[model samples]
Target: MNDATTSPADSALATRGAALDLLFNVLAKRVPFDDAWDASRPLRALEPRDRAFVRMLVATTLRRLGQIDAAIQGSLNKQGQQLKAVVQDILRLGAAQLLFLGTPAHAAVDTAVELAVARKQHPYKGLINAVLRRLDRERASILAEQDAGRLNTPDWLWLSWRKTYGTALTRAIVETHLGEAPLDITVKANAAAWAERLEATVLPTGSLRRAAGGQVTELSGFDEGGWWVQDAAAAIPARLFGDLAGRDAIDLCAAPGGKTAQLAAAGAQVIAVDRSEKRLVRLSENMARLGLGARVTTVAADATEWRPDAVVDAVLLDAPCSATGTIRRHPDVARLKSEEDVEKLGRIQSRLLYRAVDMLKPGGTLVYCTCSLQAEEGESQITNLLYRRPEMQVVPVTADEVGGLSELLTPDGYVRCTPGHLAEIGGMDGFFAARLRRVG
Candidate 1:
């Protein structure tokens, strides 16, 4: 009998199970799982449940990587850093299911053993089974005594948070990321109409937050081009433009077009520019879906090397940074980012801001934003730019612009949102945004 004629459900299970394994492999190599999601081909055909399972596996493993490794080490007699990558990934996945997820002990061990056999790593399956069984027996004491910070995060990151936000706030921030993030949607035109149509709760900033799991494209009004998925915090910088109807706007580094969609929806003639041809494909698709293609023009060029045909009325530079702010949504961020990487990203952010200011028309707004929690990337970057460019004036965002988030706004009128700030209401991502005007 030909294996190709197998039942569809069996084939799907095999594919999804393999994708989960691949996801774990990529994550064990320290590559970010979400960014890897865009690159991995195995996950493309997975059902939503399996996809969610794979995501949960990668996220829980990364969130508790330190603790998971500790648990593995504690259970092993001969712990070596040079273990085979496949073996390591299998052990981590099994441990994650056994300890973090409520997966039954037998299912976790048996499935992991089957996976190991399929991958030709059977000699170590016994090792995997023994370790996981021990984890089950010691679950209560192991979890009770685990240091929250050390178990959940790297020592340097936990220490940095402690120094920056104090112990209580830092603990809250970590706890917030431990939970899943809600899906926030930005409506195209009428918020009330879309909210009613989709049965989603309308947030104060006009974004919609769904409970947790659902088919996004199948949601009501998605096919009608009613709205797009965007975090409430991510929508703020574009809204700072207020009324941009018929105005020319430039969105720098605008691939995958969340901010570009916001600008085009506001009636701005937007030129969305980014360096990557691959990412621009997704941006083009998003614009087509929303029927905003006419208002937005896609350009493939580096912001540093490309110049606009003419200065625009406004420019929004969503500069790249360490992206620590979005850890709740993309938990892989904490595992992949290092302190040295932040310093390098800060330099790039400074360069992007310098080029953005030069490309702005006089009296035009320049909104600078980043999904980073560090002061070096937010306040200090803006402060340094202010000294270098005397012609630019800090255009403070008003209470009306932030829509009841005025307290989160800095005294200088910049918006500074942290994970700890919105902890009670499902927690918001950390983002910093500042609007400036070119006066000369």
Candidate 2:
């Protein structure tokens, strides 16, 4: 409710307060941060630089909420016990700027106090000023002492990863999410050429990796559809069906059409099926932009209920799961998702995988994958399906097929790409995929 003032100082303070409004929208109201940001009237009215700052403020706070809260509580000593909610929000925002974002200490403190006054919590101005000043002085020591990986991660997710991946590797996954995710693009063709043109580094899997910061639309190959943004791990499932030229491949649960585009680009007659018509619109538009719309038949229907008139040669079942693996890109996954949701999603994934299997032709390949760290959603589902379907059997993914990223392959021949796998080359999303064939 802060009024914007003409002075630069008041404007900066108002923008920071607006960032807090976004944070409250997410943490208090349970709104997804992206949705909140998109609908933010205040943010939309800002200049480009201020808009970017608002985004950074909110994202950095969410990404480091645990750390910021810990730092604030530590600074408050016993006085923190009865702090007002608005006061807490202001302090958290201030600490994020000072400890993590490297904002000038005086500016951070000044703006935070100003934010408190504007929020009508004028009584807490001195408390906000004192706590933030103290935090700035002890920021280094506080940071060193705290386990930010544990702090930033939700308790449930942290425990799940620790139980699933063990202590050290789970720590690595948590640590990875703290940093910004890099941008990786799947080119239409000539991966090397596109990489050179975009000034990016080509990953072993052939996806191009560029620096983490930028406007994706401004990139060289975006408008021409020469390439599309696809994570290195995500780009793998479609590639599993190597040389799809002339093959009829169905991408079940396909939306936003990255894999569909890849299948079409590979010369496959692609039928992209998804339940959400809204997302299919996006997929259709993306296909049009890439000039691959002709090959892609967009089907807006549920994969479990929609049957192809005839069995297809290959199927890519990117079944929806908890999406825990994509935490690096969507920090909301850690905040918004829960254990019960994972259980529910696991069931849905099972149903979809079953349907995808039924649509596969005799000797056709079915590549089942999920961007999930839980075995119940990934490996366990595959095990259950194989036990139930006598005709279905595992078709091992090869290191040669996946650009010699052999480290991602499991003993049973599934590809399990994790954030820990390619540490030196940024990292890939955590994904579990099994290639299957109908032997009967």
lDDT of 2 by residue, 299-387 (tens): 99988899999999999999988888998887767778889999999888888988988898999999999999888888899999999
User: Quick one: RMSD of model 2?
Assistant: 2.2
In candidate 1, stretches whose alpha carbon ends up further than 4 angstroms from where it belongs are 1-25, 38-51, 77-84
The residue-by-residue lDDT of candidate 1 on 66-163, one tens digit each, is 77888888888777545677777777777888888987887777777777787888788888788889888887787787775557777767887788
Per-candidate clash tally = 0, 0
Candidate 2 stretches greater than 4 Å from native: 1-5, 79-82
Best by TM-score: 2
Highest lDDT scorer: 2
Q: What are the TM-scores, per candidate, against the unseen true structure?
A: 0.91, 0.95
